[model samples]
Target: MELNDKIEKALHAEQKDHEISAGWRLILASALGIGFGSVGFATYAIGAFIDPLGKEFGWSRAEVQGAIAFGVGLGGFAAPIIGMLIDRYGGRSIAIYGLLGVTVGYLMASTAGGNLCYFYLAYAAVAVLGAGSGPVSWTRAVAARFDRRRGLALALTLSGTGMAAIVVPPYAVLLVENFGWRVGYVGLACLPLFALPFVLLFFFPAKSGPAAAAAAPVSTDAASAPPTGLTLKQATSSYRFWLLLFSILAMYLGITGIVPNLIPALTDKGFTPSAAAAVQSVYGFSLIVARLGIGWLLDRFWGPAVAALVLTSPVMACLILIGEPNYATAIIASALIGAAAGAELDLLAFFTARYFGIRNYGRIYGFLYTGVAFGAGLGPVAFAYLSDLTGSYNASFQGALVLFALGGTSILFLGRYPNLSAETRPANH
Candidate 1:
């Protein structure tokens, strides 16, 4: 009987290992979905489109950039509602519909015939309809799947944006150059369609099998069950929530504002357009490195400290660009900015899980993501407006310096992570 028990235990352990290995499919699917989703393709590709659309429509830089601000800002209002749906219904179906909506949105955008209002309306449709394909759903799925390596897993998932950053700039430039901006929009629309199949196949949670058993949290106790943290109201009421919101707003206002403008800024400094795009590719590579590196650091070190260090690197980037930088210097600055941009989403996802817990993750992350969307939308417009006003990007870079400092400092006060599991909660009244 003892020998039989040992053999059974050995087989069970082997089976558990196999089950854990299967979870990588979930990670890969989530990464692909995120890379091609609205946050990935739409946000990163906007920079390449900015000059073409502006020249074509005879619009100013600010006017050209405002489309994203108008779209993502207004669309962000839908995040909490989407979050509620995800928490109740799960992410897979929502992601499928959202990707399809993005495809249609891109087609609509492609049909714009130089009417500025029409362009804005098309982007607005993309934001409103495609909100489900954003980080809110993808991060929720990833956060639910991994606990021990949650930070790194979230990093890898969000690295899809990094991949988009690398591919979209050059690709967008190529399309706009070869086929015109209209065709460029048509090509961009195909990305989410590519991601849809992956999400359908792997984003779903396993049920009634060894895979399900492996996917389950290692701890099977009541404390380790799903929905293990503060409610949305409770999270909102906490001081940390407000602080995090402010940090996100400031960091994105600086980072996202600068990214879409980097190519233009480089071109202004005497680099050719293709050379500028190459620098953007370098920035994208930095994004991938930052996501993986900062993610690993978050798991081993205090998260806020890691965030503070990474977020502040962009201050140096701003300083570098404030002067007339050499091509190599410009590349370094772009890389620094990309590192901060890469770290921002990873920190937001990891912090949401660590500080707020996963009980209300969908809703909580959705509310926080509203800040991300708004900041992203507004940043480019703000940067362009500043450039338009001053006739130089230096003033905008100076403002970013301040924003990055303030944003980095705020997170340091997040203090330690709280234990908000159901078992740890105190009964009220």
Candidate 2:
């Protein structure tokens, strides 16, 4: 009845929640990881097939590329709405259903009737699944299950994307070369089916210990001090929110936005496709290295410190890119940029939870993911446009260098507020 009693009850609920099994957490995290990884493949794979697809369908380059952009925009449009729903309903339910949608979308895309409109339809459906089933959903799921090792947990979950980058592109290239792009897409459809059994039926149990007990109703004013959750309005008003937004924008704009174009950019600069693909492989390799390294740093240091370290990759990459367009330099630059991107994405989700409590994590993470979408989605088109205007890939890349630098500088400004309040901080043995 009293406020103190309510605080005690809330604490009790948290303690009970921690009783969840580690095995359960790992299974859910891995399943969500694979699902999110597939999203990366879906978004970037089209670029590799652009000329081929256009040739087969008799569509112009801009028209086919426009369809890819449309899918990205549609995904961004759907993110906030999906976030709101996840905040209202649990992420498990949404993730399970969205994976099914992804399967259907991929199957349709793989078998698209040589028409530009068919590609648009398949991609639009893929966009819907992406908003509901990607990092935002996975991060929310991790947030619900763990409180003490939250950073490590989040980093592990997001490492899926980096892994996908390392693994998927080469496999896609092989599939497209040997069989055709269509078969490569069919392979993607199988990813969601694999994820579904683990997440829907195996890993995601209905309720953890405390969530079940806390189901009883209590008077709102008496049960919580300010209340148990954050709303979108309250989140947008916070300073950290905007800082995170710009940080993600800069990372995406300078790094991931350019990643899918790395091979083509090298080819334009006089390297053969084989040479360019080799350079791209270095980029993919660094993503895995960065994820493992940053995951360790995130668990041991302040969020900003880890972020600053990760941000260095883009700045370094830009310097190399601007100095020379040769194969060696491009390889180094591409790897650096790729590593930074892989690490930054994981850090963004980890920091979002560290800085903001996980009470309304889905909604907050959704908004942040939107900022990421804007940067990554528009990045390639913008780079190409700038190249068209300047008549050089160097000029466009130089612009990206500036953006990466600006983003790196901003991370140094994250003030040293402790990650958790004394009451929320972990208890010593």
Candidate 3:
């Protein structure tokens, strides 16, 4: 038999034993690592700090939100570089050590005295440290394995992020309430430490032979041999890429801006601090559900259609929050926001594969993710500035409603994916 055929036969025989593949373990580890990285450390931690920071430093809401805007936004611009490194060197060292860098940065934040610059500088370092530790590394590893259930695998991996969201916010609140934000920083550092052991899984390759060649399902016309998809240049020039890109940006502006400010916004509306934190936990619960649910749906349904539905969800959330919300309305809105935010990164990863193909998956997704990150930065600041100007967050929610509608509408134009291969087909044509 041929060498390729021989490898395939061995893989088939190994499968007959009905054992789970090495890939699934990597998926588990990926979830843990990605969960606590930027998702928990930065995204969830910042919300808890806003009130404390405002009281301690007397910083305006705009100034506080600007910290996240600059940190996560600039770090997002580094995604393509991080993605390139992962493609070349693999993700294990970067995943573990990158988080170690984040730990150090978080430690640095606890040291800031009177100077606001120190706080901003510390967050900038955390953002840079956090770049590799996010979905670019974890999701890429999961995407490389499990073509049959790729959606489910990706969802499970990203769900670690949701798990962190569910746990981190309230924990941060408790720590801040008792020990202050400095001890809260220590608490945030501990989250990534929980995932440190899982870093070893990224050290091993998921699959090792001919059957492992394609990272995902091969497109029909390109299925005979190994399939490499469109180059970065071709992908950037396509309508599908732009459509998906702007859609993610808008959806995140609604999610990222609103999520971190949820507690403050709710408390302003007459809810107590503890009650708002409880409501925020509802958002976390919804995120866990959406991450898994959206992943399953992506595996079975049309990508753009799912994107439209999820993107529109935040509009409903914003409307509910703006329109004389009750206890139940608060719960429902928080859940919608969670579902929207949780689905954004996973959908970006899946859509990158489905529309652009998987050859330059990391690079294309990185560029797109930059937009998501930038929007995350924009969302908080936008909400804060509007709140500062109008004396309430109601204006911010109305703005989010408009942006969400535009974003949801754009994806409908993506039409069909060509699944173009980079090596065989001429991208210029």
Candidate 4:
């Protein structure tokens, strides 16, 4: 406790001396840690495994993608439990467990022997802890610490995934090219280990900051402040919650369903595999800009409006998909897709905190992210399944247009956001 005070005091002194707040640095560290692990291992790297897994097992695309659906969907269902754990406990233990679990999953995947079930179980180990070390766990600590700039803080945290997308996919491709898919999985397994120390030391701060705890008020101020939003239960009961949930679900389904197939899709369009990876790298750049830009917008304007506007990128990408895209069209289309994909969680987390307030944040956000997970699981399979059935990606891309529009349009109905009071929210929290 005394050590925490000293660190906390020094952090204050640093901020007082006109350096960046230690909280902001911690938020950046959290983003980097999550980007290094979750983004590298789960999101971007998985695409590289699709061909190798299929070639080894003689499985269909949908069959291979089943791992993404089952693992990510199951992880979403597990989120409420993880969120409760976050509320009761700080995110430190959950983050640790998540890293360990993902590592184990990747290790087990590295040992796959052409068995579909083996791959499923391994990826399940990784996704089951989705919320633990992900935005769900990391954002709470950030949210607790920042109010005024919370939108940007959450954006920065989620940008770690963007950074991961930028580097991990191409790097995974390099590993696969040089060593093989098994070795690539093993390499990914080791990524979280490198980030673990940063997470423990900086990402997860003391549960309640010394400054916040000191100024926290008792029950007498409850009526005066009047809580801004609902608990998890109330959130679930409202149309507002359902609107947000389904919107996220629809958007993410369109995203994850197609993302793992990006290289293949591009390669089919006449780009070489290396060129495909470069295109994806460009996508990553666009995703990073969109995430940070959306973050900046949320702090200033209505988030749903920003979401609705950005969500159109996917719609435009889908229209481009209807055509036989050339080099320029493919890259432009990809950048739009990346923009839509990147803005998702930033909007979800930001909207959750804004609409619901901080009281039941962990649990409410957890429930909402289940939509994200469920959509993630549903997407790739649906995409692959549609491709297999239709014998072309044109149908799948056309279908994505509907999903994107639906999600973007749905957010318009969340009603007005209520403002919370500082009395209920302690500063330096």
How much lDDT does each candidate structure score? 0.83, 0.66, 0.78, 0.76
- TM-score of each prediction: 0.91, 0.82, 0.89, 0.88
Question: Where is the poorest 10-residue window by lDDT in model 1?
Answer: 205-214
Q: Candidate 4 on 116-173: residue-level lDDT in tens?
A: 8988888788877544776678777776666656777778888888787788889889
Q: How accurate is candidate 3 locally (lDDT)?
A: 0.78
Best TM-score goes to which candidate? Answer: 1
Q: Is candidate 3 or candidate 4 better by lDDT?
A: 3
Off by over 4 Å in 3: 1-22, 201-227, 421-429
Give each prediction's root-mean-square deviation over alpha carbons: 4.7, 6.7, 5.2, 6.3
Q: Report the C-alpha lDDT of model 1 over 134-181, residue by residue, as the tens digit.
A: 888888887876776777888888888888889988888889889998
Q: Write the per-residue lDDT of candidate 2 for residues 1-429, one digit (tens) a residue.
A: 699999988976674344344535553555454434325555456555655676788764445556556676777767778767766666667676677777788788888877778888887787786556766677666655655555556556666666566655666667777888799888777766766666755546223223432552443321221113344576688787888789888878777557766655666677765566667767767876777677767666877877777786687787776665687778788778877876776777776666665555667777788877777667766775665566666876787888887887687675664344334322222
Q: Going through the candidates in order, what is the number of backbone clashes in each?
A: 0, 0, 3, 4
lDDT of candidate 4 at residue 400, scale 0 to 100:
87
In candidate 1, stretches whose alpha carbon ends up further than 4 angstroms from where it belongs are 1-20, 206-224, 424-429
Better of 2 and 3 by lDDT: 3
In terms of lDDT, model 2 sits at 0.66
Residue by residue across 13-94, what tens digits does model 3's lDDT show?
5652332254667877887888788645466667788888889989888888888888888779878888877765666777
